[model samples]
Each structure stands twice: as structure tokens, then as C-alpha cells.
Target: MLADGTIGEEELRYLADLYAAEVRTSDDAIGSFLDGLAERGLLDSSIVAFLSDHGEAIGEHGWIGHGIFHEEILAVPLLIRFPGGEWAGRYSEPVEHIDLAPTLLDRLGIPIPEGMQGASLLPLLRGEPAALAPDRMRVSQRAHGIGLSFADAPGLRIYFRRTPSGPDHLEVFDLGADPSEEHNLAADPASRETWMPRLERYLEWTRSRVAEDRAFRVKGSGIQEEDKGMLRALGYLGEEE
Candidate 1:
């Protein structure tokens, strides 16, 4: 932006190139590993899964990390090949990491342990309707104090933030209108009426999830006052105005 005058196409192309290289390298490593497995005849018996925890933002909105809840990060590539089956196709459904445990157990006819998250991969293998359904909306929270959420249900909050400061930079985009999130509506008070209530509901849901995670144990909260500020900067503040 310093020399380019604005976040123009050239800057975006540069960032895309960087991420593309990472993807290529990742593909190479996976290819090599699969080759090794095939050499030992273990590829057939082995259920291969390729997954990434999250994605990086090369320069989207002047950000560089993976805190935003953009589809780029919330969504991941999942390829699973089971043993002894004609299941070799793409699954487009929005699956969660939590669903993995249950799916695997279901495939093997083994019981899934309690308190585990994730769905099963059997539907995809069987070419079920659920597997064809699009991914359900989801949220992504990172240690960087950035939080993001999405919903098919409208009036929901879909945005990202930087770490907190006095004048915290909150970037909330109406994904319904701006799917790319190229615009920042955080400082626009005129849009608050629609977003505030939705944001409140989102906050409640977030707090509930946090409670379930046992994050507020009070024994070793691990976060300090400044941490809250950081979260605020990242747009993770929970307290009300």
C-alpha cells in the first residue's frame, strides 16, 4: 500500500503467488508420502487423510495471519480414502474437524468415545445426500484474539478484527453483500442497528462455547488485562458497550 497507492490487483497477485507456492510444496510432500506407502502395499489398507488446520491471509485487508473467519481459513481441503471401496470422489459438504472422530468410528463400526467432536466420512463413501449438501456455516477463533462466525441464517455477524487498542480496528463485513470482505463497515455507526443485536447473539453463543471449553476455570486463565486489550483489538471483546 505504501508504494502501490492502494490494495490494488498487483498486491493481491503477489500474495496469491506466495500462498500458491506453499500449496504446491504441500502437494509435493503428500505425493511423496503416498508413493512411499504404495511401494509397501500399505496404501490400499491405509485410510489416507489430507487436512490443514487453517489458512494464511497473504494481504487481505492488510492482515497476514489466520484470525479472520473468512471462508479461506474456516474451510479446508479434506481428502479421505477408505480401504476396499469405490469411494474415490470429492465431498462438497461443509464438514467440521469435530465430525472426524465420529465419522472414523462409524466407518470402522467402532464406538466413538464421549466428548469427541467431528462427523463421519461414511456418507461421502456411500454417496449419501448429506455428503452432497453444502457445508454448514461455522466459526473460527484463534489465539490472536480474532473471532469470526457465519450463518445461512441472515442478520448474523461475519467479520474479522485486528488486536485491540484504544481505537480498536473492528472489521465487520456483510458477507451477504460483500462476500469478499474487501470493505470495512466497523466504524460505520449507521450499520449498527442491524449488526448490534446480531453481534449480541453471537457474543452469547461464543461465551457459551467458551464455558463448555472450560476456558474460564479461574485457576489458570492464562490471559491478563493486556490480553483483553489485544482481544479487543482483534475484535473478540465480550463485555457490552
Candidate 2:
């Protein structure tokens, strides 16, 4: 699965088969659960939907963990079945994790407040194009605290992430051409003319949208002048006093 040739395809298939068995059982259970709710008069007016925040990586690109913005980690399975006739089906579209909230709100005819980044799922559900093109970019960053187990260097690095580059990317990729992401086109000179504007706009828009928790700063910091002086003695802060 990592393409290291250490593990055979047969082994991967076996694991996949095991997971598939579980999926079958789960799907059946969900159907039964829905049926039970229906019998209890709880399903007639309900809009049933199931969604995973992100997908799991089954050893793609030498990676086992999730959180990197790869398609394998971001493009999750989505299922939406309307209450009434003929709308039960699958939608093949590039939906983002952020879109989930907006979709539910729109379905209930509720007004989604401004600065919400996601779009409604209605267009996709109605068999319309959700735009197979890479419309939005997803980025993720992780940082460890100072004075922690790991040394403090302010770690920041972008990875190419995965093969068959889709919507999500830890770095950037041209989804139309380098879908597999075999090529490191992020630094390519030619891409500047094409993707730079979109990239800048997306970044700006992301910056404009604020999370309430993030907007508020921690007022009660334990690090006082003496603590800062001690940290500086240990070379934590710079020459600035």
C-alpha cells in the first residue's frame, strides 16, 4: 500500500475485504435503524443524512495517519436521502468538510449567516454539477507548544501529501493535470499565471472568516516578566527585551 513493495496487494485486498464486511453490516444496521424510526412515526418529516468528516487513509503514499489535506483524508463519503419520493440517490461531486453545515441549514430553509465558507448541497442533490474543478482549497497546520517534549523551533512545512491530488492538499497542486500529484508543480513557474490569483483569493477569504474561539485571545497567561526572563535565559525568546 505504501508502494515500498514490502506488503503485497493481496494483503491490502484482504484488509479491504475485512472492512467491506463491516461496511455491509453497518449499512444494513443503518437501514434497520431508519426503518425502526419510520415505524415510530419519526422518519416521515425527517431529512435523513449521513456524512463522515474525513476519509481514512489505508496506507496510501507511505502514510498511515490522517490530518494532512489529502483527498484520502478529506474526500469523505456522503449520503443524503430526502423524506419523500424520487430524490434518493448518490451525488458525485467535490464537496468539502465545511459544506456540511451549510447544506443542512439550506435544506431546512434556514438562513446561513455571513462568513460561512461552505455551500449548500441542494445543487449536488438535484443532479447538478458541484463543479468537478478545484473550486476551494483546504489547508491544515499543526504546531507543538514551547517548553513541551519537542524542542521549540516553530515547525512549519508543507508536504505534497498524496497521489491523485484532489480538492484537499497540504501544499498546492493542479488537480486538472497532476491529479496523481506525482509532479511537484507548486513551485512551477508556469502555474503562477494560472493559479496564483485563485490561490491568493482563497487564502484572503480564509483569513477573513474568523472562528470565535480563535478570535479571542487567552488573557490569563501564566508567563509573566520573570517567566519570560527565565525563558530568555534559556534562549527561548530573541534579543528583544
Candidate 3:
């Protein structure tokens, strides 16, 4: 913007150009790989999946990276093509990366391991009726902030950010009405009262998962029996006392 209220575009955008170039390179590689599969008559027999681990923020919200709760960073495309192009369609429901493993396992006729946080999305993929997911919630969190989206409440997102020296800042957006998140419902006391209580179950679940992950980390830190000898020789392990 300038003094005349005109948007200026005189500067060169080298970073954005580089990002686009990288995306094109990836596209070329993927196209080549798929062509090879087709050349070998394996295209129809393949179950191809395309997805990104996270999104990027290029000069949006004054940030330029991932690992944050912004929708620009959290939203990523997931495209799965089954063998013979079965169950091909677009879906609008909320899903996470955790669901991919279970879906693959289910498709491969393998038993899903117990206690996985994600459920198989086979029903939805196949366009079959699915049971209501009362506990369906998408949560992204860090040490200082958390963002949440509930299945029952599509297009609604809530964010909580801990300030360095004050109360946690809360933001709620009804994306259906405020797609840009310009109006924060959290500023309203009535809206806050309604949404604040919903955080309890999500917080409880987060704590439990954190505890479980901690225990697993502790167990994993133990030296393996086969590696004990090498570790002992390398002074990384002590003799049993």
C-alpha cells in the first residue's frame, strides 16, 4: 500500500518464485514416477496417495514457516487414489494424518493395532454411512499454544495462545461467516463461556497422550540387549551393578 491507497507490486518476489520452482520440480518428479508406473502397466493396480505433512506460510500473518496454528500452516491437501480408482470423490470432513495409516491397514486387510488415536476412514471413503464421531476433534498444540476444530462444529476454529506476561489470548472464528477470521468470537463473554468449557475434555486427552508418549520415550531410551555390548565398549553404557 502507498500514500495514494494503491497496492504496490514493484518489488521482486524472489522467495515466492523459489517456492513455486520447488513445487514445479516436485510435480515433475511425481509425474515421471507415475509415467513409469503406467509404462509398466501398474498404474491401475497401484494405490497412490498424495499429501503434505504440513503447510507453509509465505508472508501471511507476518510469518513464513510452518509449526504454527494458523489455518494456512495447518491445512494440507490429501488425495488418495485406490486401485482401479475405486471410491473416487472429494470429501469435506475434517481428518488428520493419523487416519492415513489406519486407512492403509484396513485396505490391505491387516488388523489395526489397538489404542491408535485415529480410526479407519474406510466408510467415508467408500461413501457409506458413518457413525457420528462425538470425540472427533482436530487439535494442534505446542508448549505455548493450541488450536482446535471439532467435527460436530465444522467451519469453527478456536485458538489459545499463552502470552509471556499475561492471560492466554483466545480466538474463535466461525469460518462459515468469517472465512478470514477477521471477527473473533472469543472476545465476547457469552461466546467465551460457551467455548471455554469445551476445552476440558480436549485438555484431558492431551495430558493423557503426553503422559503415554513420555512413558514410551523413557522405555525407548533403554539400551537394547544386542546393542549393550557395543554401547558398553563405546562408554555409552555402564556395567550392570
Better of 1 and 3 by TM-score: 3
Q: Which ten residues in a row have the lowest lDDT in candidate 3?
A: 1-10
- lDDT by residue (tens digit), candidate 2, 131-226: 332344444422211110110111111243322234534344544455554555557676554555555565555456536524442234555877
- lDDT of candidates 1 onward, in order: 0.64, 0.57, 0.68
TM-score for each predicted model, relative to the true structure: 0.66, 0.59, 0.73
- Model 1: per-residue lDDT, tens digit, 41-152? 9988887777888877766555566665765666687777777544777765567666776777887789878765555667665777544223243565544444555543
Please give the lDDT score for candidate 1: 0.64
**Tens digit of lDDT per residue, candidate 3, span 1-241?**
0233232333225657777898899889889988998999999999888888887766555555664455776678898878888988888876777888888998999999998767788988767875335335666553334545552244567775542357766668877788666787866876665666776667677767876755643235765777866755644344650
- On lDDT, the leading prediction is 3
Worst 10 residues of 1 by lDDT: 129-138
Model 1: residues with Cα > 4 Å off, grouped in runs: 1-16, 129-146, 154-157, 160-178, 183-198, 207-241
Clash count per candidate: 15, 3, 0
